[model samples]
Target: MLKENLVNILRTLQRERVFLLGSFVTLLIILGGLGFSFTEASEGGSFLKRFGEGLWWAVVTVTTVGYGDVVPKTSEGRLVGVALMVGGLLSFSLVTATVASIFIERKFRRERGLETLKETHHILVLGWHHDGETLLDQLLRRLPHTARVVLINQLPPEKMEGIRAKYPGREPLFVWGDYSREEVLLRANVRQAYKAVILAGRNEGETAAEVDQRTLITTLTLKSLSPKIRILAELLRMENKPYLERAGADQVLIRGQYDSSIMAGALASPGLYKVVDALLNAEGFTVWAVDVPSEFQGSPVKTFSDYLKNQHQALLIAIFSEGRALSLEDLLGDEPSSIDEFIRSKFVETGMTHLFGRAKMKFQINPADHQVLGPHDKAVVIAAQPPNL
Candidate 1:
């Protein structure tokens, strides 16, 4: 019974207008008593009569229904009654306005599932968790400052607000919904996004099967909607990597596999880890992709190196043929019918890695090994260091 009463009290408190009404009524009664007492002391009226008049005055002041039936003759009594009346009205209005707003917002959200987006070429982040937040911070740091990132998560407003307060600056537009649903992705404007990052949901006690199921659903939905959008997903399990890739994700970062691969490479050579870390971090030995023009069809790789030193102030790294192959052959001597063919032949001759679905230039490989020049080939060069480091 006691718990029930407490719950009732909390419910009543939530209906703030009722509290406001009761407060106004109580204030009126108090004001009336004070007014009657003051009038009695001044006019020498009977105690009962003074009390009655004071009650009347208090009621009128509190309700703002001043009937002028009983008046405050003393300056002190009048001032007190006036203060109480103003306080009562202000308090009542504030409470009523707050209650009304709560109802209105709830109704609005019920009618509309989520908000819309306007910016183009922006990134869309699905789900909100520790991993999501980390990815958001990294993207904000890496991408151009003007780029917009929209967050779609299933968390409530209070929870989302708490997460948002930690990040001060232009916050990403947030869409709260179950990310597995196609409607939620559509609401987030996934179709127009430049990239989509699907993060793993935190399911501490849940079975791995359930978690993988959820991740696969989200990935499939995103691909179905915008097949062209570059989807970078994080797959927790190694077995799920193929599913994510088949779902059309441009890149899948398998946490375990990636770490293991790096570790394995590092075990072979300690410097390998440092180089890989620097390259991935876009720091120290950075890699940039520089384009090769059509006019330089027959220009040797050496000429490009000279140009980088003098013009772009960058070192000429390995060039990716139009077919994305790194080669160790002479590019100028091998005259091909088309630039694309030339790059293809050169890339095959030299062993290089090409990241999928992205244009590239020469980067951290042996440029001396591949000396081919193609209109579409590029050079990825490292630039300067971070500021204030």
Candidate 2:
């Protein structure tokens, strides 16, 4: 504790050295002015009156206010005034220097992403991409207005003027740096974050592969720092999905694949895009993950489906479990099962089974009645509005 206190004191001194110097000089000036006041008390200056007046004069002198309410009547007092004037100049110089340094330091943090945030339960958005503005808008609309956020990306400081302007008072802290670096992640406080969304910053580098590669590196670094943090990452290459999964990313979006699939769907089924757009809209009827009834546990999938339709007045579309969507892959005991196993084992090991219990996500359009409902099974229902998360 003593060593920690010493380190803290040193840090404070380092940070406030200029202010401290100004204060020291101001104190000296006050003392000297008072000494001169005492020396010249018999020469038309009152010792008690002049000393009190001298202190106020010294302050006004430092501030360059020059109210002139009090004046030194003796030569000695005039000499003290000269000393005070010099000190005043130095003090004001220090004040200007401090303000300029503070502005420069803030600019440096904005440019280099050097802020070490220590907030808890914050949602971190890493890697600003081509779609970043759109993402930001949607996120702002969907998330609670009060949710704290940190955005770490490689965008230059000047390029972020739009974001600052748009947010006005509630701008998510912008950490302009390489997200793949541990120090940059530290700036965003990955360990304390509730979740993270990693965008594929195509503009930061050359090819799609390059973007995905950087994203993969960032995912690995984040997982290494905080294994429990839920990370959603975008990958341009489908092949990079495995790396993200291995790196413990909870959700991975293959950008090219989704765009291609959606385009194909649009081509095959005209107006399908409109329906999807409506479903994904932040403020509209959208697919939401909701808790299954406690009574539905161990019941067949059909039972929960009926309950959701009857009770919530919603369509039970799918169940999302583990990390990604529950699918035919899970029924086949393939990818989803492996991930589920990993999640189960990890949750049990860390006594975080409650989180898993709350995150039960399984899926079926019209599942067989024989298939039982599992604990932590959340129902993805198409509802009129999103629930409070």
Candidate 3:
């Protein structure tokens, strides 16, 4: 852990270039102090004879803020002082120029989306479409203000600037490159990202199949880099959903999958689509799914619903679970039964070994009122904000 922390600190300093400035300053101070103390040693009981006093004198001299409180009384001491003064002027000028150059280079790199990010647990949005700005806006609205985001794409710097301008204080970092490439992902710090949202690219002249293929490759690359990262991917065709899932995406959303149903509903009943749109896109209120609190375990669905409504002003409309969850140890058992071997063999044969330790997610909307809440059960509700409970 200590070594890992040290590596992380070094990585941060390297990215920020703070170590350069610190090392230069420390070296100059130490050398100046040692030289001053040795040269003034003949002056017995002189404050400059002490290393601490020499350091103070060195600081004032290097900064050219001579207080005249400590002066060299001998030829050797004066020679040392002259050397320090010349070194200080030359060194500080070089340092000032170098610092300015560094800042300018960093700014240029950032504006051109060529900078490597150091943000951890940030959300990564890869690829882009014509309506990508809307997706970014929604993500920013849903995420907390403290949440960091990095966007990886080939969009122009001007486009990125316009997008940043739209959100005054919540602008996301940008990396200009092909999102499917591992190098670009590394530049965006994909290994440290909490989650990644892969969108189907609408690059000029690219077909839908090509776009879906790119999305699949991006998902595979991301999972290889960070197996624990949660990936939410968009698919242009419903047929590509299983491929994306096999690529290790946590969730796959097919473009316009619900459009037909919504359109039919709107035709059958006037204003139905408007209601659906409001529920999904309206300000102030939206749907959320929260795990059942321990205190409400085994409570009836109706009871829990009532509690949410009364305590948090949230309307509970559904109770659901992500299927029957099981751990690897539970499936394998201590004795390693034939059944365990059989399950393991099947997972390996299907090239879905990763799924062996994961539960398949499924949602059951609006369960019976008398149904009791289980440990894995979650309540789906419409609320202004997430409830504290």
TM-score of each: 0.53, 0.71, 0.75
Question: Model 2, range 203-268, lDDT digits (tens) per residue?
Answer: 733898888777866765675577667888988888768656654566788876667777888898
Q: CA RMSD for every model?
A: 14.8, 7.0, 6.6
As a whole number from 0 to 100, the lDDT of residue 81 in candidate 2 is 79
Better of 2 and 3 by TM-score: 3
Q: Give the TM-score of candidate 2.
A: 0.71
The 10-residue segment with the lowest total lDDT in model 3: 324-333
User: Over the full model, what C-alpha lDDT does candidate 1 score relative to the true structure?
Assistant: 0.65
1 versus 3: better lDDT goes to: 3
Q: What is the lDDT of residue 336 in candidate 3?
A: 60
lDDT of 3: 0.79
Candidate with top TM-score is 3
**TM-score, model 1 to reference:** 0.53
Clashes of 3: 0
> What are the lDDT scores of the predictions, listed in order?
0.65, 0.70, 0.79
What would the per-residue lDDT of candidate 1 be over residues 97-214, giving only the tens digit for each residue?
Answer: 7767765865455334365544577798877666666666667766667888887877776666665566677567777788889888877778788788877776669765676667
lDDT of 3 at 12: 58
